[model samples]
Target chain A: MSGNFIVGQYIPGTSPLHKLDPRTKLIMVFAYTIGLFFLPTWLPVLLAGIPLGIAVYASRLPWRYLLLGLRPLWILLVITFLLHLLGGSSTAPPAPEDVWATLGPWTITGTGAATGFTTVLRLAWLFSAASLLTLTTSPMMVTHGLERLLGPLKRWRFPAHELAMMTSIALRFIPTLQEEMDKIIKAQAARGSSWRYGSWTRRAQALVALMVPLLLSALRRADDLAVAMEARGYQGGEGRTAHHPLQMTRIDRWLLIITALAGITIILWRWA
Target chain B: MNGMLTLRDVHFAYADGTPALQGVSLDIPRGGKTAIVGANGAGKSTLFLTLNGTLRPSQGEIKLDGRLMTYGRRDLEQWRRQVGLVFQDPDVQLFSASVEQDISFGPLNMGLTEDEVRRRVEEALIATGTEPLRNRPVHALSYGQKKRVSIAGVYAMQPDVMVLDEPLAWLDPAGQQEILALLAQLHRAGTTLVMAVHQMDVVADWADMVIVLQAGQVIYQGAPQGVLAQQERLLSVGLTPPWPVQVFHDLRLAGLPLEGEPPLTRAALTEQIVRAWPKK
Candidate 1:
C-alpha cells in the first residue's frame, strides 16, 4: 500500500521551477491540461513534451523520481493505450488500406494506432506537469496559492481559507497517519491477524481492526490539535494574515505570461 | 498570593462527568520554573488547561496578573495571547506543513502584520535552534525536532506564561537536557515556565517551585527543597521521591548522623555524605 505513494513528497531544491510562485505553477498546470485536450494532431501531442521536458530539466528533481511517480498509473495508461490501439469498441469498419496490423481477428487501423499513441503521450504530459507542481512547491504554498486564488469568492460565502487550512493540515498529517497505520498493522499482525498472507476475508477483517484504532487515534489527535491551536490564539481565518504571503516576482510574472501565451498559441495552432 | 496566573477553587469535569479537576487552586509565579507532578489521571493536564483558559472551570475563577479571566470571544483571544500552552504530543500541536509555517501560525493568528509575523517566526526558529529545519516538512522532523518546533510555535506568540503538558515525556536524556536548556533560556528572558513532568530528578534539579496533584486536587505546593522532604506525602500520591532523597532517608534509617535537610540532588547528597564520612 505504501509503495506507490509518491505524489505529495516534496523534494527541496533551489531550482528556478522551485522558486516560481505556486500560483503561476498552478495556473500553468491547469491551462496546460486544458490545452492537452485540444491538441488536434498526434504531432502536437508529441510537441507538448517540449515544455514539459523543459520544466523537468528546470526543476532539477531527478527525472527518475518523476517517472516513478507515474508507477501507480501505468496500468491505467497501458489499458487506455491498448483500448485505442485495438479499436475493440469502435463501431465503424476499418478501411482495407488503413490497417496497420492484424492479430487474432482484430485489425489495428492507422487512425486507431495514432489515437492510442497520442492519448498515451497526452496523458504522460498532463501527469508530469501536475507532478512538477507538487514536487517543486510545498503543500502549504499550494494551499496558500489556492486560498488567494479563491479569495474573491468570499462574497459568495465561500470558506476558502478554511478549506485551505484543511488541505494543509491533511498534508501535514499524512505521514504521521501513515506511520501510525504502519504501527497498527504491525500490532494487529502480532496478535494473530494475518495482515500479509491472509485470505481475502481475513485481510478485510484485519483492515477493519487496523482502521478502528487508527480512526480513534486520529480523532483524539484532532481534539488535542484543536486545543493546542486555540491555546496559540487561532480563532479562525478571519482577520488572519499570512506571514509568507504569495508574491509575484518578475520570474513569476514572466512565467505566467509565457504559459498563457503558449496555451493560447496551442489552441489557435490547432484551429489554424 | 501575587502570581502571573492564579486559580481559585477551579473545578472541571469532562462531558462524560469524569472529574479531572476538583476545587484546584494554585499560583504560578512570574519568571519562575514551576513543575507540576502527579500520577496518571491525577488532573495535572486539567490544571494546566485551566491555567491557559483552554478549559473553563465549572464553579471557580482564574486570574491572569490579577485580572479575572472572562470567556468572551475577545477576552479569550487576548487571554490566549498572554498564555501559550504546548501539548505533550508535538504531532498534535504542529498542524502546518513545514517548520516555518507551523511557527508562523501563532503570530499570524495574533493578527500581526506580515513583516512582524515573519520576524517572530524567524526569532522563534532561531530560539528553538530549528533554523536548519525551517523549510523542512513537519513530518520529516525527528521526534525531538518536532518537540522543539512545537515549542517554537508557542514561543512565536511571545506569551507571558508558557504552559507545557509533559514536555519532557518520551525524550531521551540528551533531548531532555536540550529542552531544559531551552526552557531555562526562556525563563531567563522572563517567560513564566510551567511544566507537568514525571521525572523527580528533573523536578528537584530544575524547578524552583513544585506542585503535586493527587486525585484531582492540589496536595502539595511549595519550594522544591520543602516538597522533596515530604517523601511520605508524595509516596502516598503515587510519586517517587528523588533518588538522592531516597538514599538520604535510607542512610538516616541506618543511623548515619548526616543532617541538614535531605539533599535534593545527587551532587548535594554526595557532598553531604563526604563531609560526614565516618571519623571512627
Candidate 2:
C-alpha cells in the first residue's frame, strides 16, 4: 500500500527539465493534454513521441523509472481498454477488411482493437506527462508556476494566489496527512477497534469510528498550522513578496517556443 | 525591560465555557531557561499559546518588552516572530513537506529575502544537525528527526523567546539528551528558552527558574531548588518529587545528618550523602 502514494513524489534532481521554470513545464503539460485529445490521427498521436522523448531525455530520468511511476494507472488503463473493446457502438458493423475474429456476438474488429489501444495509449501519455511535471518540479515551484500562469485571471477577480496557496499547502500536507491517517488506523487497531476483524458492515462502522478522529485531528492540525503561519507573519494572498521569485529565464523562453512549435506541428500532422 | 514577558490576570475559557486558564499571572524573564511545570490540562499549553498571541485572553493584558501586545495584525505578527512557539507535536507544527522548506517557512514568513532565508535555513539545518536530512520528505523522517526539524524551523526565525511544549515528550533517552544539549546551545546564544514539561525532575537540572502551575494558576515560581525541594507539595500537584528531593526526604526521615535546603540534582544529592556519611 505504501509503494503507491505519489502526491508529492518529487525526486530531487538537477536535470535541465528540473531547471526549467515551472511555468514553462506547466504550459507544456497543458498544451500536451489538449493536443492528446484533439489530434485527428492515431499515427500522429503515436508519433508525438519526439517531443516527449526530448523531455524524458532532458529530465535525465530512466524510462523504466517513468514507466514504474505509472504502476497505479495500469488498472485504470486496462479498464478503459476493456470497456472500449466490449461495449462501444453495438449496431455498427466491423469494416470487412478490419474484422479479425468473431465470437458469440462480439466481433473483434481491427478498428475496435486500434481504438482500445489508442485510448490506453492516450491515458498512459496523460498520466506520464503529469507525473513528469510532479517528479521534476517541487510543490512550491508548482504553486508558483500556477500562480504565475493564472496571474492574468486576477482581472476576472479570481483569487488566483489564494487558490495556488491552498494547492501548495495541501500538496505539502498530503504525506503528513497520509502518515497521520496510518497512525490513527494503527492506534485504533491497538485499541481493539477492528476494522477488518468484523463483518463488512461492522468493519465499515468501525471505519466511521476511525475516520471521525482522523478528520478531527486533521482539522485541529490545520488550525494549528494557520496559527503557526500567522505567528510567522504570513499576512495574506495580496502584497506578499517572494524569497524565490519565479522569473522565467532565456532557456524558459526557448523551451516555451519549442513546445508551441512542436505542439502545433503534431496537431497539424494529425489533421493531415 | 527588553526581554521580559509578563501576563497579568490572563483569563481564558473555551467556547463551550470550560475554563482553561483562570487569572494566570507570571513574568517570564529573558535570556534564561524557564520551565512551566504542570499536570495535564493545567493551562501550560494555554499559557504558551496566550504568551505568543495565538489565543486572546478573556480579560487581561500581556506585555512583551514593555509594550502591550494587542491582537492587531501587525502587533501579533511582531509578537509571534519574537516569541516562537513550538507545539508539542512536530507533525502539526511542521506544515511543509520537506525539511528545508519547513525550516524556511518561518524565515520566509518573516519576509526575509530568498538569499537570507536560504542562509538562515542552512544555519538552522546545521544547528539542529539536520543537514543530512535537509531535502528529505517530512513524512519520511522519524519522530525524533521531525522534532529536530521542527525546532530548526523556529530557530530559523531566530525568536527571542522559544516556547516549546513538552520538548522532551516522546523522545528516547539519547534524543532527550540531544534536545537538552540543543536547549543549552539556545540558552548560550541568549534566546530565552521556555518549555512546558510534565516531569518535575527534568526541570530541576536544567531550568534556571521553574514555574509550577496548578488548576490553571501559578502555584509557585522561583528557583527549582526551592520549589522542587518540597516533596509533599510536588506530590500534591500530580508529580512525584524529583529523585534528589525524594532522597533528601528519605534521609531526613531516617534521622541522617544533612544540612541546608534539599538538593534538587543528582550531583548535589551525592555530595550531600558523602558529606553527611557516618564518621570514619
Candidate 3:
C-alpha cells in the first residue's frame, strides 16, 4: 500500500521536469526508449546515459526510487549479462593468439568480459530511463496525454473518452487494491493462518482462504461503486467536462524540443 | 398519523430453504425513534433489508406513505432513495477513495448538481462531525470514525427514514455516546429513525417505541417504559431491561411502595428513588 509502488509515481516538486506537460513527457519517454534500442556500441550507450542522468536529476526524484523501480528486472539483467559473457566467443581454443594474458596457472581472454559489461550497462541505462519517465508524471496526467494523442482515432468510432476513463479507473484502483491486500494479509495473520512452514498444498489452501475474503470484498466494493456512480449521475461518456484541464505551457514546449533534438542526435551520431 | 412503514404477513426464506422471517408484521409510526431489539440471528437484519427493498417477502405487501412497494426495478430504486440504510460494517458502506466522495455518493446518485452535491456533502459531514476527515482515505480511518462516515454517507442522501443495522456495535463508550447523540439529533430534526440495537440502556433512554423480535416475529411493540415493565415477556424474548428498570424491580421486591410507572431515564430514576425513600 505504499504509494511508491504505483506506476507513474509523481514526486511532488516545483522542478521544471514536473511542470512539463504530460503529453510531452509521454512522447519523450517513447522516443528515448526507441533511441536507446539503436545504440550498438558502448560509447553511444554511455553517451545516451547523459540525457537520462540529467532527466533523473531534473525530476528531483531520489536515486533510490529509480533503483527500486528496477528491482523487478534485476534477474533479467543478470541472465542477459551471463548469456553474453558465456557465448560471445564460442569456438575452439585460439592458438594462443586471442588469449590476452597468462598467469602462472590461469589465462585471461579479451572477447567475453568486455561484451558482458557492455550489455549490462546498456540494460541499466534502458531501465533507469524508463523509471525516470514514471517518477515525473502523475497517472491521471499521463492518461490525459493518451487521450489527446489518441484523439485522431475518434473519427473511426474508437471511443476515446471511454477508454481514457477506463484507464483512469485502473490507475486509481491500483493503490486501493494493494491496500486491501495488506489488510487481508494482516487479518489472516491475526487468524493464525501460517504462510510459513507449510507444504505446497497447505500453503495453497491457506492462500485460497485469504483470497476468498478479499475477492468477495472486492466484488462488493465494485457493486457499491457502480451504484455510487449511477447515483452521482455519471452516465456513459457524454456531456461531461474535466475539473482540471491538461494545458501545455512554455516549459513543456522547451522540454519536448530538447528531447526530440536528443533523440535525433543520438540516431544520427550512431547510424547516419 | 399513518406509520412511516407497515408490513403485513411478510414471509421470507433463504435460497437454501431456511426460513429467516415468517409471518412478520409491524408498523413503525412517523417521527418516532424505534429500536428493534433481538438476539443474534433473530431476523433483525433481514427485516431491515426487507424494508429497503433489497429482499422482497414471499407473501406480503410493504406500504410506505400508503403506496404499496412492489418488487420492480423502478419501484425498488425509489424505495431505496426514500429509506437510506447504513450497513453493519462501515467497510462495506464506504467503498469510495475519499470520505468526501463517499458522503456525496448518495446525493450524486439522486441526480443533484455539482453545487448541490457539494452543499449536501458539507452538511452531512458537519452533521456527523466528520468534516475534518473529508479528504482522508477511507481505509485509514478507525472503526468508530468509519462508522460515523458510513452514517454521514447515508445522511447525505436525505432519506425520509434512516435504517441502521447494529449502529452501536464495536464502538467504545465515547463512540456509543456520540452515535446516540447523533441519532437523537437526527430524530429531533424530523427524520424518522429505526435502528437495530443490542444495548438495552440505549433503548430505554432514546427510543420512543420498542419492538422486540423473537424467531422473526414481532413479540412485543409498545412504548419503552411499557416494554421494560414486561419482564416475563422480555426474558422470554432473550432481552433484559435497562439497569434502571432492574433497580426499580429490585426495589419493588424489597417492599417499597413503587410509583405509578417505571422510570426510563436517569433523572426519572433518581427522582423516583428520592420519592420512595421511607419516612424516618
Candidate 4:
C-alpha cells in the first residue's frame, strides 16, 4: 500500500542543470512551455526539440529514466492525438488545395494529422520539461528559489518567506504522513478490514474507513509539527534569516540567455 | 531551588476541561541523568511540555536558570532553544526526509550561520553515530536508527538541558544501552538530561534522582533507592519496588541478617550476595 508514495523525486547530482539556479531553470521551463504553445507548425515544434534535447543532456539524468517517466502519459498523448485527428477545425468547406483523403464515411485531412501531431508534441514536451525540473532539483531548492523570486513582492506586504516555509514544511512532512498512512492502513487491515477485494461501493466504504483515521492522525501530526517548529524558534516570516542563502551564478544567466535565444529562434523560424 | 528547571505548582488542563497536570512542583537537578517514572495516566508528558512551553501550563509558574518564565513570543523562542526535546516517537520528531537536513533544522532555527550549523550537524552525527547515514532519507531508516537520528536532531541544537520522553521505549537491550551511554556522555559534557522512563530498574540503575507521578501529580521526589525502598508506599500509587529491593526485602523476612540499605540495582545486589556467601 505504501509502494505508491514517492518521498523525493530528486536524484542528487552535480550536473550543470542540477547546479543551475532553480529560479533560472524555473523560468526556462516556463519560457520553454510558452514557446511550445506558440510554435506555428510541426516544423517549428520539431525545431523546439533542439532546446529540449539540450535540457535533457544538461540534466545528466539517465535519458531512459527521463523518457520512462513519460510512459504513463502515453494514454493521454494518444487520446489528445485521436481527438484532434477526428475532430479537426470546424470549417465551411475544405479548400481544394487542402490535401484530403476519404476512408469510407470518415474524411481524414492533412490539417487533421498536422494539428494532431503538433498537439501531441506540445503535450509530451510539456510533461518532459516539467519532469526535468522536478527530477534534477531538490524540493527545498525549489522552495527557496520560488521564495527568492517572490522577494520583490515583500514591498506589497506579501509573506513570501512564510509561503516558502510552508512549502518546505509540506515537502518534509510528505514522507512522515506516508508512514502514518501506511501504519493506519496496516492497523485497519490487521483488524480485518478487506481493502483488496470488494465491490465499488464496499471499496468506497473501505476508503472512508481508511480516510477517517488518516485524517485524524494527520491533524494530530500537524499540531505536533506546528508545536515542534515553534519550539525550534520559527518566528514567522519577520526578520527570520536563512542558513543556506541562495545566490545566482553566471551559469544561470547564461542558461537563461540560451533559453531566450532558443525561444526567439523557434518563433522567427516558425513565422518565416 | 535553582535547578535546570524549577516548576512551582504548574497546572495544565485540556480545552475540554480534563486536567493533565495538577499542581505539580519539581526541581530537576542542573546536570545529571534524572528520570521521571510514572504509569500510563501520569503527567509525565504534560510536565515535559510545560518545561519548554510547548503547551503552556494552565496555572502556576516555571523558572529556568533562576529566572521566572513567560510564554511571550520572544521569551518562548529563547526558552525553547535552551531546552530541546526528543519526542517519544521518532516519526513525529523527524520532519525532514533527509537525515542531515532534519539534524540541521534545530540549529538553523537558532539563527546560526551556515558554517556553524554545519559544524554542529557534524558534531551531532558523530555523537549519535549517524555520520554514515547523514545523506540517507529518513523514511529509509530502521526504527532504532531513526530514533538515533531523532536524538541527533535535538542534540545538534546544543541545548543547556535535554528532555527526552520515553527515550528507551521500543529499543532493544543493546539499543537501550547505546542511548543510556549517549545520555551519560552528554551529562559528562555538562548538558543536563531529564527523561521520562517506565522501567523501575532503569530508574534505579541510571538515574541520579527519580520523580514518580500518579494521576497528574508528583507522588514521590527523591533518589531511586529512597523511593523504591518503600515498596508499600509505591504500591498505593501504582508502582512496584524494583526486583533488587524486593529480593533484599524477602531475604530479610526469611531471617537473613543482611541489613544496611538494600541494593537498588541488580549489579549491586549481585555483588552483595557474592560477598555474603558462606554466611557466618
Question: lDDT per residue, candidate 2, A146-165, as tens digits?
Answer: 88889899999998888887
On lDDT, the leading prediction is 1
Residue-level lDDT for A59 in candidate 4: 78
**Model 2, chain A: how large is the TM-score?**
0.91
Candidates' chain B TM-scores in the order shown = 0.97, 0.96, 0.94, 0.95
Fnat for the candidates in order: 0.92, 0.53, 0.11, 0.52
DockQ of each: 0.74, 0.54, 0.22, 0.53
DockQ ranking, best first: 1, 2, 4, 3
- The most accurate candidate by DockQ is 1
Tens digits of lDDT, candidate 4, A1-272: 34552323788899988998889988888998988888878887877787789888987777886667778889998988877676665564556566477667556677878889998888878888888898899887898888988989999998888898788878776666777778887898898785676788877888899889888988898888777676666677664547567778998888788888887887787688
The residue-by-residue lDDT of candidate 2 on B1-280, one tens digit each, is 3448998888999899989899888888988789999899888988888988988989899999989988987787788889998878887777766789889887777777778888999999999999999878887899999899989999999999999999899998899999999989988998999998877778888898898888889999888877888888988999778888898889878888888889888999999889888642
Give candidate 3 regions above 4 Å deviation. Answer: A1-58, A89-193, A198-272, B70-77
* Index of the highest-TM-score prediction: 4
Worst 10-residue stretch by lDDT in candidate 1 chain B? Answer: B271-280
- The local distance difference test score of each candidate is 0.87, 0.84, 0.78, 0.83
Query: How high is the lDDT of residue A22 in model 2?
Result: 92
**Per-residue accuracy of model 4 over B1-280 as CA lDDT, tens digit each:** 3487898998899899889899999898888778898888788887887888888887898999888998887788788889988888887777775899889988877778778889999999999999999988787898899889988998898889999999999999999999888888888889989999887788888888989889999877877778887878877887777889889889778866675788888888887777665583
TM-score of chain A of each: 0.92, 0.91, 0.82, 0.90
Q: How many Å off is the CA of B157 in candidate 2? A: 1.5
User: How good is chain A of candidate 4, measured by TM-score?
Assistant: 0.90
Kindly list the per-residue Cα lDDT of model 1 for residues A1-272, writing each as its tens digit. 43455774777889999998889999999999999999877998898899899999999888897788887779989999888888733678877898888998778888887888888888988988988899898887899899888989988999998899899898878778998998888887787886567699988887788889999999999888888888888898876876466889998998889988888787678778
